[model samples]
Target: MRMVPMAEADLDAVLAVQAACYPPAMQEAADVVRARLRASPDTVLVARDADGICAYLFAYPSRLGKVTPLGSRFTLPDRPDTLYLHDLAVAPRSAGQGVARRLTDAILARAGGLRHSALVSVQDSRRFWESLGYAAAAGDGVALATYPAGALYMARRLSA
Candidate 1:
């Protein structure tokens, strides 16, 4: 699958692949996507194939640095510089491929001109994120994960 900038035409297919990859509580609904797209269009990316969307990456600028989101409260800051990756999902049917990496490359490409780091709360796939050069969140008590199967708060500083 090839990575692409998400557009209005790709919303339904993107959401479908997202739903297939993650649960409702963790995935953004159409309304949320609309809101986020309007406010933060630079933070979304999608990978597609002949069938449809295969993977996606969602991000937002965060000035709060690496404040880990626990439960429902996310530590968002106004006009932040750091790129916070909210989620990365590849459809179950597309797991073995390099879709996630290409999607991530798209996010990194977007974040390249920024001044802050790249952050992600990794879920059920610690090794995957590690392979991409993301490490556990800095400092003590940073290992907490809210995901049902648990996850790690990981980040990598983007050279500015």
Candidate 2:
């Protein structure tokens, strides 16, 4: 699969992939996802193979210890030090095809001078993020509470 910047046209497919990956309680509405895309278009991406978009990754610049509560709009910081990976979903059919890794790598490659990268690991995907060098980290308690049970806030320092 090839990685490309997420476009408005990809929203439908992105939503489909998201629905297929996450439970109803964990899913964010389309409007929330669209607003995030507009807020930081450069950090959102979609993976496409011959069939079509099979995965997506949404990220934004923010403080390392902060957590974006589910369904809330992203409030970008004036002096961001971390790239927060907000969401990542791969179509069930595309699982194990390296699509998620490809999208993650692409976003990290675009992180520029950020000092770290973080994400909220849900749906029991902690091992996947851990394999990518992330480790459980503290986050805003109130914000973290918005997630389902067992969700973890994870982060990793970036190499200069």
Candidate 3:
């Protein structure tokens, strides 16, 4: 699969992959996803192959120590110091194929000037983010409360 910017044409497939990867309660609506795409088009990406979109990563410019509550629309910080990796989902068919890693690396590559990167690890995926150099960070307890049980806010410093 190849990494590419997410386009409006890809929303259907993106939603499908998201549905396959997350439980109903965890999934964001199309409008919310569309708003995010509008807010930070450059940071959102999709992984596609001959079959179609196999994975996607939704990210946006944000401040360190900030948490985007589940289902909330993205808001670009006035002075972003970090890239917030809001969501990453790979189709069930593409699991164990390293698609998630490649997609994440692609996003991190675009974050060259940022001072840090952060994410909310859900569904017991903290170890996966840990392998990518993210560590659990102190987060707003109220903001974190929006997520399902066991969600963690993690961060890692990025070299400029």
RMSD of 2: 0.7
Compared with the true structure, what per-residue lDDT tens digits does model 2 show for residues 10-105? 889999998899889988999999999999999999999899998999999999999999999999999999999999999988898888888999
Q: What TM-score does candidate 2 get on C-alpha atoms?
A: 0.98
lDDT-better candidate, 1 vs 3: 3
- The C-alpha lDDT values of all candidates are 0.68, 0.93, 0.94
Q: What's the residue-level lDDT of 139 in candidate 3?
A: 77
Candidate 2, which segments miss by more than 4 Å at Cα? Answer: none
What are the root-mean-square deviations of the candidates from the true structure over C-alphas?
3.4, 0.7, 0.7
Worst 10 residues of 2 by lDDT: 92-101
| Tens digit per residue, CA lDDT, model 3, 1-160 | 7999999889999999999989899999999999999999999999998899999999999999999989999988889999999999999999999999999999999995999999999999999999999999987778899999999999999999
Identify the runs in model 3 with alpha carbons over 4 angstroms from their true place. Answer: none
For model 2 the local lDDT of residue 47 reads 92
TM-score of each model, in listed order: 0.78, 0.98, 0.98
Evaluation by lDDT, superior candidate among 1 and 2: 2
Residue 47 accuracy (lDDT) in model 1: 82
Count the clashes in each prediction. 0, 0, 0
